[model samples]
Target chain A: MKLASATLMLSAARVEAERLGVIVCVSVVDAAGYPVAFLRMDGLALGCIDVCIKKARTAALFHMDSADFARVACPGGGAYSLELTNGGLTSFGGGLAVRDRNGVVVGGIGVSGASTEDDIAIGLVGLAALS
Target chain B: MKLASATLMLSAARVEAERLGVIVCVSVVDAAGYPVAFLRMDGLALGCIDVCIKKARTAALFHMDSADFARVACPGGGAYSLELTNGGLTSFGGGLAVRDRNGVVVGGIGVSGASTEDDIAIGLVGLAALS
Candidate 1:
């Protein structure tokens, strides 16, 4: 396992998203859910920025992706939650964890784009660039 | 004067959707954003459930749809701003208002699933069923 900069990883995700013809908002954060770097594409619907960040944070803190949280957390129910249905967290796929070279889960990356699968794939490839 | 059965309007909208091969989530609300009648199609994503509600709320409460609010709310903006991009309110095109026969603007409806245009179309047709 080698090491890479979180900042660099964040930018790489952005680049990859552009290459894929998808405009996305990407978030990189520590295991605690605090942001490392965040970026949202132009015309990316200003509303998506924070949602991506929060989902990334949720994934990092809970050590599970946002959808997983949404699965466990039903409407008006759960221990760890995807309560964003109230509007702050989007559990609609797209969020994933970012692990370091040591095989340790270092942080998480979340993306919002064309579709749920596209967002998740963008995050994985973006993190891969850092590795 | 005659009347529109709230339940009937809801059912008609669902029927129309079935004819179109689109499973949709529909929300009918009073002017206050409270549910007059709400229904989520089988297999509709759970996160989108509340999103339609609040977007309907935002459309009714502020007298504007979620997209309109997002246009005004900034990155970390204000009190009257559209704050849900952080996750609660989806400004994405699935929300609209429903006025009464008296033209008093009594309520609103929101639809989600498929594209933005499709979502809005479902809501409009749903509202039209009441007329």
Candidate 2:
């Protein structure tokens, strides 16, 4: 995805975050799991910055929302301990893969610095901006 | 620095990288060494993603260019073996601290995936954009 487009998506996500009254760190990564864009709002938790980017990387690499991947990475699941691989993955909510109109995966977005549900909401807002 | 400004810097750096015929991974970190932005050009070496971020983090935390810090981290230098600390620093080239007009450090930028000199040049392009 083009960097300009990624910036627009980040802007939209930030608006949603403001509406939700939560500051956040957001990350965008291309389909190959390479970072395309990232933003950390002022006053955000420093640790969540890495988590946000890792979540986006995880979503892009796996081509699935991080929340869904959490199930697959759970105990007795096929990909247990997968988070330990590939630098580190976030298997919980808040990461979503971005796909083009033809449904081809283009990138992924991850949000952090809030409750998991709110983070997921913010991530969806970013995904919406792509479509 | 704001994410929009960081994106502008990344865009400018990408233009310079294209002119140089090199693809690179770029990262921006806040004053506290927290990641604020990151990008990897298409076809860039995957290994450089983490390296670029680490370089930016090192620059932000140390308040100096990675190339300059290399001398300090050299054997018998004041900060020898410093690279082994703080999640691993990049003492070579391609990382630079970002300061405001008042000369207050606000962030840092790092570039990787090319020769050390080229990386440093690209990093300067990004820094110039921030000014």
Candidate 3:
């Protein structure tokens, strides 16, 4: 994905976090899990920095919402222990695959620093700005 | 620094890389050495991914260009072996500090995948876009 589009999505998530009165870290990664853009609200928890990046990477690498990956990564599931791969991944809510209009995966976005539901909501807001 | 500003700088470096016909990676890190933004041109070498980030982190952590840090990190210099600390650092050209109008350091930018001189030039273009 172009850097312009990546920044657009990142800004949208930041706006949503502001609207919800939450400070968060948001990360965008290309299809190969390389960073495209990232931003952390001032005063955010430092530990959330790596988590957000890993979340977006997980989505981009797996081509699935992190929550879905979470389900499949359970003890008896097909991808069990997969989160421990690819440098580390966050198989949970708040990370979603980014696809072009044709439904081809292009990148992924991840949000952190809020409740899991809130983080997912924020990520959705970012994805909605893709156009 | 604001995400808007970070993206602006990142775009400037990317534009420079395009003009030079070099597939490169660029990274921006805040004063605390946390990532603010990053971009890797399509088909860029994977090895440069971490190098660019480390270069930016070196500048941010030391408040000097990575080239200058290289001198200080030489065998008998005061900072010798410092690169092994703080995760890892790249003490070489292509990394420079980001400063505000007051000349206070705010962040840093790093570029990789080209000659050291070309990388530094690209990073300078990025820093020039800060205003």
- DockQ of all predictions against the true structure, Cα-based: 0.12, 0.02, 0.02
Worst 10 residues of 1 chain B by lDDT: B73-82
Clashing pairs in 3: none
Candidate 2: clashing pairs of residues? none
lDDT of 2 by residue, B41-81 (tens): 99998999988988887787666788886885544343333
Task: Output the number of the TM-score-best candidate.
Answer: 2
lDDT of 1 at A108: 79
Report the TM-score of candidate 1, chain B only: 0.76
Q: Which model, 1 or 2, shows the larger DockQ?
A: 1
Candidate 2, CAPRI quality class derived from DockQ: incorrect
Instruction: Report lDDT (Cα) of residue A14, candidate 3.
Output: 95
What ordering of candidates by TM-score runs from best to worst? 2, 3, 1
Error of 3 at A82 (Å): 1.0
Which DockQ value does candidate 2 get?
Answer: 0.02
